[model samples]
Target: MSNEPVGVLVIGAGASGAAFAWSIAGAGMSVLCLDQGPWMKQRDYPSNGLDWEERGLGEFATSPNVRGLPADYPVNEQDSDISPLMFNAVGGSTILWAAHFPRLTPKDFRMKSDDGVGADWPIDYQTLEPYFALNDRMMGVSGLSGDPAYPYHEPPLPPLPLGKSGNTLAAGFEKLGWHWWPSDSAILSREYEGREACINLGPCLTGCAQGAKASTDITYWPVAQRKGVKVRSGCRVREITVREDGMADGVLYYDEEGQLQEQKAEIVVLACNGIGTPRLLLNSKSQQHPDGLANSSGLVGKNLMFHPYAMITGIFEEPLHGRRGPVGCSFWSHEFYQTDRSRGFVRGYSFEAIRGLGPAQTALQGMVQGFIPWGEDHHRAFARLYDHTATLLGITEDLPEDTNTVTLDPELKDSHGIPAPKVTYRLSENSRKMLAHAVERATEVLTAAGAVETVAEPLMRGAGWHLMGTARMGRDPKASVVNERGQAHDVKNLFIVDGSVFVTAGGVNPTSTIQAFALYVADSIKKNIETLFDDA
Candidate 1:
């Protein structure tokens, strides 16, 4: 660790961290970031090998508990209805993501005023619009203009080819007269900023071999490094140390060789995801702040949002060749996105289309769904659903609930002996209603699109990729952990720029919005740099 204090110290070199680091470093301040995971190389991505599918199912699994890599800390998911999934590499979960980037709508920011379901965010959609646009320019988004579902903003590139899976799903949406649009993807449809175009590789959940998918390691980190920003890998931050003034002095971390070290910084920024961020705060107990630093509101690990998902799959007669294109981003319908009081639910969901699975996954899923029998007819059953199934994943709006939480487990700990996050989550009544409605509507779309056999999974345990709403933002210091500018309510000069700061989880994905929020916070910090440490 450096003896001299840096201008800003960022923890977790993930999506939000990379974006904020790049933006803040551009303001000419010496920025240094520390990540627990190593830098992922594009050449070593799973897609480059013939056993890509197997690798994705094993070592590169999305859930840290399943993967159990050296850099990963095991998350206790036994108590949760759905398992939390994330990656810890330089680009974070974006490394294993499908690149289906979607922005939260205007109504998402004002859930309290609009639907009376959740608390409203201090900042609205309009406040982050410019930052969203700026991030799209840097990260590169692919979609057509005039999406009516959102405020007008043209994507940087043309949409990816809908392929047979999307066209088939579009026919269903048209027949049902529902709202459907091509996904606005972070995966490049065409080459931009020296990256090559996507070649329609099947396994997007694994790392992108062609560098078509815009993981921050390839996109933001390179730029940030060029601007003189420094990032250290394989360093696990154990806790934050505070001074007598109750201000953040720096962090205590385990280095690459498992040696404990201290690094001082003038300002500390946390870009760890919802679970990780809150876990860190709750673990950082100090004399000045016993309950945890910046946790005076007693809401650090509360209000955890997983965006409860339900998947409905339909088996068709003809082959859709679904795996030929991007599996994660296809056409999706927002026919049930907004809150409709008459629908018996406060909020709604989005039916995002998913392509068919691989040979191994298809067989495994078929057996779990009780369709493919073993012994005699296993091959026959597997062949029927291999490339002939289309799935619609219902991404629901999960409201904040204090009961659903991320607490430090007493027994569970990482290799560094730091407490692991224990997730205790359950689906709320509103989520249950919204999920049922979405499944029914999605089944209709499948039937209209000529499905022969349809099966519904009300809860997708493996689909808990989007985590948000832990350390939420609000104007009232008593109710929130952070302010509108992403500054911690109790700890000035310390900021959070991750999904933990989301007030509510919208129906769509939160990645794009997370990046926008990070950039917005960096911009705000630059503007108030002089008075940033006054509270200290």
Candidate 2:
């Protein structure tokens, strides 16, 4: 086999990896991105057909913990209530994401200082603000600027429409004197950059057939590839090899044909989110780093966090026309986002306006949620829940704990004979209290909007989307896996550009901040490529 040295080797072509690679493709450095899954075509997305909901629950489901495809490595989630959801393909989970793009508040970065609950990020929000704008333009975000919930920053496109469901919820919030705004979305509001406007096909979580959703495969990858960034799909990296000088040299991976191959690189960057990043590091054990590379702090697989979610749905007498627009939540309220001493929880949660479910989901949910009966009354119950339901989801801020961790399963291995990631998580007391408060408030809103009946579920199944904080960033090498620049504290040439390095898990969606950090770290790498080994 021919072996050649690569200038930069980025593992995992997800949100962070794609953003970083795209930013540095023109900086006179050869970059190669290796993904474990295949490069999927937009035409082959599940939303192209009538069986979209079935496809979403089956192959295109957000969770690798659920989707169990050949390309997906099984995650052992028997110990956790919230199962980890991730897509192994080129665009990562964005292929199945709802495209809700919300930035972390400035206080999210200074969690330790502001609330004294979790660790503070090595970098601040102001440091990432400009890159947030850069990524917004690249991904084509849609939102209204200058909401009192956050600091002022102009959006690239106008806000996505607030359908009848959103309007109804807004009226309730207005009556209650609470904060609410049209959510920032990765979906296009109008035609831009050769991409078509959203056709509002509903069920955007499965996929977007109109090419309106800004998955990196349709956004950054196209431009990055054109600028000479080489992407190798169907390649699962097994380990990062170390050179004689105790620096990262390259990676060993299993190719499509299941053959072991070694690809050398001067710099090795990991964008494999939280779980995958820790798993790879723990598996890559060597004599110089016997406990796992860059793991001298013993925090590689520690502090695993997933934003605990709660769902509350209301049954209305009138249909809200939820089937006519994007399937994801249309509006959000950050009124309860900050910490308040009287709230009984340190960090707060955000509420989103979720649309009604599809026919199959509606029937299943009705049966499960218990207002709809079985056997004789099933049809009548289903009719009541069909298009007359509105939902609100509360994404709670989960604090980091050493007990909530990702470890290697001793017995389970994947199709490639690699050890599987075992997630062990439990809801904290603070999180439980937050969920209760969110459910109560959501029920009040729905009741204010004239809901005949309401159902609330504090902990929803299959809601773990943002996996973060396994390899945290800090100023001290002994306490953190990476530094402010996402550089591994122990390994000089090894870097991470994903949510794994996040110090805290914010209440809102993390994709926007994940991309912003990727851009910031990419600029840092480009500026410090000559001095990358100076105690990073």
Candidate 3:
């Protein structure tokens, strides 16, 4: 059955969806957001369970193919070098992210103009600065001012204390004389806004049971609801429907009970992220727009970026607050974030440190590395590696290439019988060179930090947290799926408010910038509401 039409129907109530719904509703527009996953309760987070680590490695795992829940879809990653990992829940991946918050540098937006590499964004970082600050306050950012890497700005909260791991890494960076700054985390350091402060519980990648992490479910969704927004969970949208006039009608979805229903809307915003957005767009074929909605550019699922990563863990002789930790970045280095012609890569990468690992994860990873064998000396070897390790994650930037893509799998389908998304990605030679450079430098830093030994994984197949550039933004309809305001180039009333609109992938955590884009797009729509559909 068809439901009453809404002013805006937002698919995927994740980071972008939550923020966009809040802003649009504040602008006096009726907003209804739907998500395939259910709203997760803090009490139900894996950290609250007795077998928290077990669940975190399983059902709450980052890979949807491994999670294999009813709400989840299997991503075909066998052919790809790295998996496109994501969460289906309201907060999306933020529920399990390390919360390393950093803004995109000015050069990131003008890559082509400055570095002659990737396409330049329609709007620059200056155009998005105010929105970034607004998002910082909304997301409860914790950071110090005077960061040379970014333009002048202060986070809403103070910086998190750098424990032993952070201090040790800081010394190494100081010795090398590089640019290192305390991480701007989307987590509360001190109690604020009814949320508790972080206790450094370490399993942030699993779930922050303390409610200290700023997942949008707790950050924006409540405010949006108070501002007259409606959110219906467990509604997996099959496809966005179109009217004869070539404007968005709404979407056809499967409700929690698995019943088919249609919801109508005046405007449709896609916040389904890089992979899901393209999957839905390609599934939405009609007589008016045959090559899926807004696919006239033939670039909907092209230019997929995975941010190919490298993990380097140093084994120290002494424990460094390993018992209690912030598994995410304590501080990050931007020394290599800018392009260097001598480095043989157009863009650069960032080094973020992992202070510690959970007992189960450490054991599993140690076993895989043959550091902790199944024999009697396992305890001794485990003790040697336990609290004495510091890992540096190299976030290498993946340039946008049309060869990489997110297409619908012909043979694989979800429980509801919808074709699954297939990821076909290959690491560019530039990225390979960057990873090599990053590994060498990282090894040097670890050595300077007095590490007895170091282990390095040049490329991680599972490190696909930042999925971007699937539906790139551009001024020309023939080049990109969406315009500067995130409006679909083909369908004026349709907008994409997720990472799908990212023109170039930056070498940092993208959640903060993703939220900024959502707020910016929402404001852009409100400002141009009168003329938004005139061109249509």
Q: What is the C-alpha lDDT of each candidate?
A: 0.91, 0.89, 0.89
Model 1 weakest 10-residue run by lDDT? 1-10
RMSD after CA superposition, every candidate? 1.0, 1.2, 1.1
Reference-based TM-score, model 1: 0.99
User: How do the residues 1-536 of candidate 3 rate in per-residue lDDT, one tens digit apiece?
Assistant: 33788899999888899988988996766789999998888888887877988998788999998899887988898879998788889888888888999888888998998889889999989888989999999989899999999998999899998899889988898998988999999889989899999998778887789989988899999998989998888989998898988889999999989999899999999999899999999889899889888999999899999888999999999898754755785899999999889987788999997787777778889998889988889899888888889889999888999999999999998888888889899999999999999899999998898888999999998989998999999998998989999999899999998999999998998888889999999999999999998888
Q: What TM-score does structure 2 among the candidates reach?
A: 0.98
lDDT of 2 by residue, 1-536 (tens): 44578888999998999999999888887899999988888787776888877888888888885688878999999999898999998988888888889999998999888887788888888999999999999999999998888889888899989888888878888998999999989999999999999988887887778889988999999999999999988999999999766789999999889999999998899999899999999999998889988999999999998889999888899988887677774989998899987988889999989787888878777778776787898888888889898889999999999999999999888999999899999999999999999999999988988888889999986898999999999999999999899989888789899999988999999999999999999999889878878753
**lDDT, residue 201, model 3:** 78
What TM-scores do the predictions have?
0.99, 0.98, 0.99
Candidate 3: which pairs clash? none
Off-target runs (Cα >4 Å) in candidate 1 are 1-3
Q: For model 1, how does the per-residue alpha-carbon lDDT over 163-279 read when each residue is reduced to its tens digit?
A: 887888889999988999999889899989999999998888989988988899999999999999999999999998888888898999998999999989888999999999999
